[model samples]
Target chain A: MTKVKDIGEQGLLERLQRFCPPDVIGDDAAVLVTDPEQSLVVTTDMLVDGVHFSNATTSPEDAGWRAAAANLSDLAAMGATPLGITVALGLPGDLSVNWVESLYQGMTECLQQYHTPIVGGDVVRSPITSLSITAFGQVHPNRIIRRGAAQVGDAIVVTGVHGASHAGLKLLLDPQIGKHLTTTEQAALIKAHQRPQPRLDVLPHLWKILDNSKFKIQNSKLRINNSPSPQSPVPSPQSLTPVAGMDSSDGLADAVLQICRASGVGAVLESSQIPLPTAFDHWLTSEQALNYALYGGEDFELVLCLPPEAAKTLVQQLGQDAAIIGSITSDTKVLLHHQNQKIPDQVLNLSQGFQHFSP
Target chain B: MTKVKDIGEQGLLERLQRFCPPDVIGDDAAVLVTDPEQSLVVTTDMLVDGVHFSNATTSPEDAGWRAAAANLSDLAAMGATPLGITVALGLPGDLSVNWVESLYQGMTECLQQYHTPIVGGDVVRSPITSLSITAFGQVHPNRIIRRGAAQVGDAIVVTGVHGASHAGLKLLLDPQIGKHLTTTEQAALIKAHQRPQPRLDVLPHLWKILDNSKFKIQNSKLRINNSPSPQSPVPSPQSLTPVAGMDSSDGLADAVLQICRASGVGAVLESSQIPLPTAFDHWLTSEQALNYALYGGEDFELVLCLPPEAAKTLVQQLGQDAAIIGSITSDTKVLLHHQNQKIPDQVLNLSQGFQHFSP
Candidate 1:
């Protein structure tokens, strides 16, 4: 019957620290001793209750899972290996201890599965509930993927299904729309929205392609040399690296534009080439489905550019779930290329995200 | 004038990056290549509007100063050196670009003055404006300080003024409280509340003291036999170390209670030994002034345990600015002694802080 307030902030921290791994909490700051050769990668993301998740519709566990996943996905996009995560939570006084504990449990589920430890954190009294997670990771100098390295002739590739989370979000927000889907279908969509996976497993292949591409002028040379030689240290024959990459948090089109803007190149995305959610046709019109695939956001899928052969090999190794979505170009404009002629329309729309300060 | 919405999230980041120095703001995460000899020390803190600071009473710069100082004080408590910081901001729309820019300027003034780079960050749209900062530091394993290391015989030392900020907060909330004070006194109190300087500079002296103390925890076992021998290296004749440590973010009594709980030791605080602002007596009784010194928070001053000789040396080195306020004891309760008697009452109240989840 101990309320968080009853014990006080320090008491609550002591209680939480009892369950957390020893040496991680109860210090001014957690200490991490890492490999000297590796570079530390850090990314931060903030999730506000009403903005990122609806407390009425989502459990604390789900909210925690989603927030951690968002930052983890950023690391995965950079081909970085997870190290530790530091969280800062601002909470309302009325929140239950059970809710906060469940939230930590959800974050631990994802972070532990990936070997990322929860190191240290701060909790403050806030009128509105909010959490900010700063995730630490490590990536080899040469293996680090950037959004600006795509070449003009490289092929665009993406992993996993796109827009399922968007579909799931719509269903979660509107039970009326979800009523049309089968119970199993509804559950799958809801799961996508609640627990999108970070693509930590796909880094090896992505790094290989980048190593082979050898744009050494723009990149720090990796420990592995991928030049044509008997000693050529290609990680795997099927595991190819991409020229450039980023995660699709703001949908495929927006991610592509980010790559283009960074690389000083344009892109040509084929609508037919994109792998949309299987239940898209059952839920909406073709245009709406396309919109979701191109600009719906929160897929957590990495989008990268590879040589045609390397892209094909990557797709083959990653299975039918991964596919070639498009190609890089010199036009400096991102265009949606459907059947035959170019669609002459911007692939990414300005109205895609839950714009925080929308007028 | 370009509103933040015009650039959108990505565009605003780009605009900010233009002035934020190269390699600080463009990546998914910044890569920190640090010295291998030191351990990575990380701490995170968040400031919420209406919770930590108010848009009505506080300027963005003052809010920035307090937030940065809080995290910096934590690092200083551990005798760690500042490395860099990553910020995650959650902002409502209709917030002026000018306001946000000024906020950054304030943060930059503090961080840059300390040579701690503003490394990487994320900006998100939220219904309420808030900011979370994760700061990185490095500390030597041999010199690492902990709150639980206080010994029974040690002088409790603290740097800088106390209760001034609390008085300043009171004045900020209600201007009428300042009517009796001279303009100089009012300005001093207001400045104390607005800008609590982080004690990062005091770290060198602390580390030297700890190194001299040479409890020889791990490395000593590796080198020194710890038995009476000529081979044993006791560091210095004059430079001595404190027994344990922490910063006073939550006032002296609470901090003393925390050290007691952590170290399984108690403390004896003589009211006569306590220091107060000179103007305090003119405005309030001696009891009220003592209460403010013992219970007022956010001083960002360090409260550490030291030997009498070392405390003298520190006071001499730091001038009259540093004071030996109390001592550690075998008794397992914190006692506030006045004249010759220990006050038989709770030294600290549980309801003191801005307790979140309070019923």
Candidate 2:
């Protein structure tokens, strides 16, 4: 066996160096040239073999997509436009070139959809396959939305229906679940589990909706310029900011609690108001549906709080895609309202989430 | 063993979510807020156990420093100001938390020197230890330099002395080499081999010298800037640019050839003009010195081409540290000039630099 020292550091870097294009390969960092005025957004996600994906069930392509999507969804959740990404891949000795190419193909396809480019990365030999992706995006500086900004009395909105991914995962892990579903249905669910689509389409219109809300929130804050089509005045940092926001990667209920904790507030979620996929109902009971809606992880949807005055315009702007699932409250607790009865707050404590070491 | 599926995807994400502070951890990526007007620069480096470091010789702290330095040097080479970093670590099942903390401490100490924060990262179990760091810096977009900008008639400039790292490695791997040196000298060489300091201080002054050309050359189009200043103007898109420019990670000779290939040009490097550490002469023969300087990797110094007009100012700015090591020629070959004789060109057909796949 060739020991690592045999190749040396220079030799290792040179071999991996050829895998990257020179334009962005060797610099201190790869440059993603965006319009100077835009705010650069960045996010990173890591995947470990056997922890995030199983070699028994997942192809290398699926593993790559899951790894990339996990990071890309973070960009989508912030409503930031995709820019560029760097991949850090760890491969075992038995890994083949074909596996790496397939993985790259999956990553490249996703990147192409969002117009993000793979600028540079590092490849190293490991005892097991591990992958980490750091993705970059650009958005207008003032328009860059954050998870901590959601407000009290604002409607909580989420993009896309939830729970199918969790259901698909269950089916993938237990073939018995697959026995009940039609072949096409099982395939659809499995695909959803493997390749979750990041919601990039909603980003461009996010700031516009927020701006319209600002006008409703405080009429005095709106200063319309007379030159040509006047633009809305830039809002002060303290005014009409998002009071509470989070991505529902850990299920809507878990994310809601996180937002509440960060903002020093509570929330009242209407159980009936939560969106569930039609396929989800076919697979699970109403209680299971509610459980999944509240706690199913990997939804990759945003759960946001907007002030009441801004809620109407925001909903109108988002159309049917965005839902009003709850409202932020002064009480420092997360409450689930089912019908007319209020259930005791039950917080889900995740011992580990998507971590490699915990299990 | 606790299977990863038991925790599930959302569960795993939620488990590790607490490691990231809410203020910086955005839904998509960790949002590191630096100076808003400055352009965000990004770089990544990955290290695997048995590949980049060995259990026999490297400590956890040394591994951490080397990993951070690898990425940090990329930033230093770009002339960008370091800001923050995210780390993704993969560990074996039996790995200890104490080991992880020590690694973090080493990384923290290095990053703290430049005031770079650990914004976020993910950790997972692997069969062997692996680490990946994605570092972010800020620079002016127009000032961001690239490798393909070297022009003809431009003087070639390198930062600091080369061969120290290669010699240091040789000494570390062969304990017999240490017999000739004092304890402190041996320790210094070992430390250099384990934890090389990236030249962050020289970046700010790089463009000043390159633009002025204190080094001598015949052609003027290829201007390589590896200094860490964010204010340098970006080369024009249409600029014929550097005949060739690269970081001396894989020996100066190999890097020069890379530049030659990139710019469709050739180079002639003078041996006596090249700088070398005094200690290196005793350990290595003149021929070995030449070979190390030519093909040895991991020096992390910048090799750049500049026009003749910029050579004087470049040397004046860099002072004694800068050397006019080589010049670009239209002949499309890399030649050595020694004792007033032209040595025959040597071809490095196989990528002779460091690779992650050897083991």
Candidate 3:
């Protein structure tokens, strides 16, 4: 019997190359060779066997989609349009062909939605399953929105309500909590946890809003063009400036702290101003909601700071869905204001953010 | 202990999102934003612990460089200019940091040669070390080549001599052979096995030759008009016309058969004409050299077929470095003509290819 180690590294690579199609088989990465006018965008994420998922619960399909989506979210974060992806899968000998096919199906679904294809990959047998996906996208070089560009005095806003994914996870993991929820409620929460959507819809609108900020003095010309009549007037675009922003992958508190760290500023959040789902109140106390919103991770929502005038205009433009839950402050510390009192200084320092190296 | 399974698929992904810098974190894969006009090429290879390298004999640095080189060779085979890479490493907790850093250092050196940066990657603990690399390259779309395009009656040419790497491996694994060679000879053989170069220098010349082929007729007219004498001739560009081609990863015989199958044709190689390295002769018998050339894998040289007229021009242009080892034939079966006799059919039919699924 030949073991993988017996064949050696160069030998194993030689064997894997036999399976690749001659076209797109060799190159740094498989080249799409698409049009050159659009710039390329790239992202990567890794999954460990015991750390990322369990073979007992996660179907290969969900694992595959989640692996791809983890990287896709980065593209969405940059406001880059999706292109294609390459996957590197490590599997134990016990892995079945059926498992790989199902995983591919899940990945196919995500790729179809983004109009990207699986260009190439490497598959090798391992003692455990560790899947890593690297995705690429296209965007105009000038349109890339980085995390460091946020400004001070921008209205701090979040795209959606936080705590649903984390709450759903708690319910799924603990059967006791599952017993309290109806089947419909349980399914909704699980779906949110399993297949969260990247906020692709808001990208174009966000880009347009940012582009409008480039020309402040020419506001009258823009207003006149937008107005139906020459005499009619519209609000100035400068009043709606978006300053500093980031997507909340960590808890809201942690994400806000990161944004402040990047912008060299601080923030204060009003406890009453934070939004919560209707069912959240039924499951948790107000304190729990605050805790979940502040420290429970995986919200996948954008937290942004914009000018007060821009806040009003943005609200008018984006409607009531976007929430203004906090304000940037000069105090140089992220503070939670509750019931007309400042929380204890020690309470604000809780370290709940995810750490990759933590055992 | 927080097990990955307890977290579920979505929970694990959310956890991953927390650590990834939101700026370049997700999409179907990571989108490496680069200029659009630049050609994009991709290659991927996987190395499993025990199969590719053992902790006892193979150093981490060699393992890493070999892993990167395997993919880089595919890019070289495509004549694409190397650019960047993403790595996915699966490690055991017991593995030392010193080992991993050495691996990174080796990979960094190889990447630096091509000016390709390590754009992103995922690192996770596994039961064994499994490394996967996907590299990217840039080339003009017109210059990019594919393995399926080899034509019938094309001259089969190969870059450099084959079997040195395999000979080196034989010497390293067998101490008996090591004792037969002097210290200098052993070192040379070991070096060949450890560091295989991807021929990047020939890429530009190959591209130039391919470019000239496209407009030969139009260029002839322009040449006539510009010439001092009407009879002055415009030198014909060398041919890189591979109707069907592939790297000799699975031994020359298997790769040649692949080209034959892809082109729906066959091939004939003269046994006496096949180039064998001096070291190959020292370690292997004449019969063994034939066997290794037919079945011994890890010889990254390419096997290409070009039209007879083009072959003459290519041979002249490529000079002695590139050898015309064989030719595409009309027959359905790959044949070897030795002297006047065909030898026994069993010798040519010997299966000499690497199979990943072989138990």
> How does candidate 2 fare on TM-score?
0.78
Model 3 docking grade = incorrect
User: Per-residue lDDT for A96-151 in model 1, tens only?
Assistant: 65566678878888787786667666667676778899987777644556675577
Q: Residues A210-329, candidate 2, lDDT per residue (tens digit)?
A: 566444355223212211112223444434334335567768777777777755667887777788866766677667877766767787776766666555566666676568887878
Q: What's the lDDT for residue B233 in model 2?
A: 42
What is the lDDT for B152 in model 3? Answer: 52
lDDT of 1 by residue, B127-225 (tens): 778899988777654444556657677788878667888898888889898799998998898888888888887777765554554432423332232
The alpha-carbon interface RMSD of model 1 comes to: 17.5
- RMSD each, Å: 12.7, 11.3, 11.9
Interface RMSD, in order shown: 17.5, 14.4, 12.4
Candidate 1 local accuracy as lDDT?
A: 0.68
Query: Where is model 1 more than 4 Å wrong at Cα?
Result: A1-36, A174-183, A208-242, A281-286, A307-310, A339-359, B1-36, B174-181, B213-243, B281-283, B307-309, B339-359
TM-score of chain B of each: 0.78, 0.75, 0.75
Q: Write model 2 residue lDDT over B248-319, tens digit each, in one string.
A: 775776667766775566777777778876665566667776666666667777776666556555566767
What are the Cα lDDT values of the candidates? 0.68, 0.62, 0.60
lDDT of 3 at A215: 38
Candidate 3 residue runs with Cα over 4 Å from true position: A1-38, A213-246, A304-321, A328-332, A339-359, B1-39, B213-244, B307-321, B339-359
